[model samples]
Target chain A: MYANRQWVLAQRPAGEPDLDCFELRETDTDAPTDGELLVETRYLSVDPYMRGRMSEQESYAEPWAVGEPLEGGIVGEVVETESDAYDIGDLVTGQGTWGEYSLLAAADVAPVDPSVAPPEAYLGILGMPGRTAYFGLLEVGDPAPGDTVVVSGAAGAVGSVVGQIAKLNGCHVVGFAGTDEKTRWLTEDLGFDAAINYKTTDDYQAALADAAPDGVDVYYDNVGGPITDAVFTQLNLDATVAVCGQIAHYNAESVPTGPRKLPQLIAPRATVQGLLVGDFATRFEVATEQLSEWVAAGKLTHRESIVEGLSNAPEAFLGLFAGDNIGKQVVQVAAE
Target chain B: MYANRQWVLAQRPAGEPDLDCFELRETDTDAPTDGELLVETRYLSVDPYMRGRMSEQESYAEPWAVGEPLEGGIVGEVVETESDAYDIGDLVTGQGTWGEYSLLAAADVAPVDPSVAPPEAYLGILGMPGRTAYFGLLEVGDPAPGDTVVVSGAAGAVGSVVGQIAKLNGCHVVGFAGTDEKTRWLTEDLGFDAAINYKTTDDYQAALADAAPDGVDVYYDNVGGPITDAVFTQLNLDATVAVCGQIAHYNAESVPTGPRKLPQLIAPRATVQGLLVGDFATRFEVATEQLSEWVAAGKLTHRESIVEGLSNAPEAFLGLFAGDNIGKQVVQVAAE
Candidate 1:
């Protein structure tokens, strides 16, 4: 037996979740059962999708009940193993509880190579966020060479990689971020042709028209609201839009309203498709391998706005709504 | 030389077009030019799409300038011909002016056989609206057996056919219309599984839930407004929406606002695509052949709400906004 510290849902959020919604409490874990591994959590992922699970609304992911321990992607070291799939002290990544230790099934977790990237990367660039940007952009957005590709939430985990992958496909990439620093990182560091600070920009349509003179052929939307409405106005003929996330309205108590866009789509005949990364589970290996190669060759770069300590995991998750993270936001629960 | 009466755009509309927006005037037409045919208009099509041309807004179709004579689909008798492709007294259909007589290039018009259907049928079920329903439903909506296909404007020209085609595809068909008569026509005459009078129904979501208990698998949206918002709520996983038209917003002075629908799409991964029938020009023959066969075999039925004389053309056009016509709306310019 081992002592553990875990975070549980204390109460449901009415709008934006606060620290009061989460309660960290002491717990105990049993030894690894057959086909299981006892792992000590090193890194925990705090994503915007977690907001959906906190509510009772019907969504692709199951909602978490009050008093239930929160579960998420975790990078951990196997402390004890009951299966040959993982040896003791081996680093692995899988869905685990928001705690210091988790007894996860050996078949559920995959071994991570520390040589290719740091262990925390498995919870970010080498994980769900990376695979989402890959298939969502290529399969749904389907940008062709010279096509103008626009990304909302351009500084977030998925949008940052979406813009870079579009560049590799020989397309003109434009991104919408919240801050001047984030926009600069996109245009200067990530090779985005142009970036807009949506927070400061008064007229998104005018800004987008000036940025994409040829009009946008592909739109990968992470932040949906006024930013998305403006992009819809500048869509080129046969434009494709991939709806990945809508962090802007995630905290709204009621459904938000915006300009009706179906009329605008008729003239350009644009297509909008919603996507979830879990749907591409079969093709995750292909994305992981390609993303790993890009990282190794210095072609793709990733940044993690990591908050230290398991107790701060709730804050890290709330920061996503505040646009506090420049890249993938992760919580460092324990040192390697 | 021939004396002709035609309708011209007197002024652009501020909101909904009124009788004052159109002016009927007498004009003179010359003999057919080298490659032209002189056609005496028999049937003129008055469609909802013509409303777009009357406005200066950028749309798929070119906007008509003030004082310009409107042009649309016409079924006429070719009295004078300059090409061997057409003979004198041939019944034909093509893009022609609203005047009694039009000089059209031989290559632009197609000869219509009255034996298959009436010459005016060439303006409707055999023309743009029929082809619009075909490709829009099959190619874009892609409904399969056991799927629940919902159509807005279900009593209108394009939508009536869309629901029928969906029925032929072995799918459950539901439609939303504005009146009790139209709803009856859909469920009883058109073989729709269920129909809702949106005007009488205050809670569209609840009405839809009762109609499509399994949720909507394919939505062919011709009227975009509250009905569309309700449909977005009940979308099944991987549903497809073909946006063919938006008559609900056609008369609005400014862009209309509605509940933002992108977030709702994420959970079901639904696809919303805009479609214009003109894009399927190359496959018009295939649709015409299939639709004609369906009509002749009594498997497909069509009704025309025809207003007598060319003078009522503007009234027929304006009546679309009021939902006065149940099926294909046309103006009978002359006798067959």
Candidate 2:
């Protein structure tokens, strides 16, 4: 019998996390039930949202319990199926255990279209990250044509897609990323009007001023901290800040303090709204189809930084905050 | 000719204001010109927002010019009229100079009705504060029935009305104030479910836990600081934070830094929006009429802390930040 390997939560992190917080263990692969499908995970998504689950603090997503396997979006091939909905060798993607094998209910997984793009794209551009960008940018950010749309954590899974979508909406898109490579990718490949290397820039305000001459009208915020404060000072009248993530402060032992922005909002009559992709669950298919069309038409580009092997999943996740990956970070757990 | 005494802006204050920032000067009043109305000021409105105008900082309202007379909402009687639209002894309320007499166009001011409530009520419950509460609560706060609404600076003009409006929307209202008397007024008279004297309470979270058993759904934020931080932690899922004012930080020499709340907001998917009464200018008459009915039907109760005389306008304005008055803080400059 084959063994199933998974990375489990070993301990809650204090401040910045290390490999000690994760425990990789092997277990016996269970047989499929009467209504279950035996899935072998081909790719495992490692995202900033997973950081919130590593801690026991209250968050939108429930915390991962110590000694339990972490759960996330996984792309896998159905090895066997007890139900008629999914057959053997069919690729499927859904929320699954971060393990080499999983027994999932047929209704919980959606069939993946590897023909349109790579099988891994189902977990990146065609999945949660894609939907997050679609609704967060269109509904929450509300970028109008000719408006300047600024996105933080650009060149990441959601942020990259956000900039592309904003461009398609006829707005000038500006991006902020950690490295020169990411910034170059955003501006050269992703069609961003301008991109700032936040790590290399000494003055974020000046950098934004040079890049965004018209001022930010729609700020899609993924990394919240001093960068966000700098962006607030440049927000145009009636600017909208779509708070999709706060990766910068996710690992802090305590809530960090910063310059208050509420007073600044009053002057411009701006709006700051926190968002979750699950809130738009009913429109996933719409967004996914749109994203697929864009990708196919060469209007949208997706880049993936994949780590090989199941044991390296924890490292792949930790790399997110370190700015190690330029785009979607995923782990190749096994071959189909 | 009669002399008109007016309070002018002397200099911008560094932190908290002093009497030196205001200069009272005597000027002679000229006779009314053709189609002009000569009005004798009756009541002068003093509000917390006036602090922003005193500083050179950018805000919703334009800054007050140094050495020029400050203009604010004033209720006055028509002592002489050259236009057929207004007659002698008619009471009117509009943005007027901080002086005893003024020449105004008849169309610039609205006729105040003494029958609905006292003429001074035109500047309090039937005026800006009331309309601010009605729109900010209904449109921005968007409280649903049975929702728990928490209001900061609950004893102040806009906040007091905000609590009542939330209550009228069938929400359970809780308030935070500086003094026990103000808290008592919020609970006993304003129909608030609970009131907490934040100045006396050392533990805000525990106080909120004891008060808001179901958690806060709609937070009408009037004072933004530590109290606002506490409220952010207690927000329910999809909560709304209506940012009406930040009176607590108005007097600070520099922009104050505090615990970053964006991360906290991510979990609740909350919204923080800035509001101005002028935003709903098109619907002001509608709200004013509804507020007038509420006052007549005894559905709404408003309290005014009246300071006597125009010479004390500077003191009355200063009293707002010190929490010296409850509900509407206005100066009865002269009797009708």
Report backbone clashes per prediction.
0, 0
Regions more than 4 Å wrong, model 2: none
DockQ score of the complex predicted as candidate 1 = 0.91
- Residue-level lDDT of model 1, residues B226-254, one tens digit each, is 99999999999999999999999999888
Worst 10 residues of 2 chain A by lDDT: A1-10
Q: In order, what DockQ does each candidate have?
A: 0.91, 0.79
Predicted chain A of candidate 1: TM-score: 0.99
If scored against the real structure, what TM-score would every candidate get? 0.99, 0.98
lDDT of 1 at B19: 96
Q: After superposition, how far is residue B196 of candidate 1 from its true place, in Å?
A: 0.7
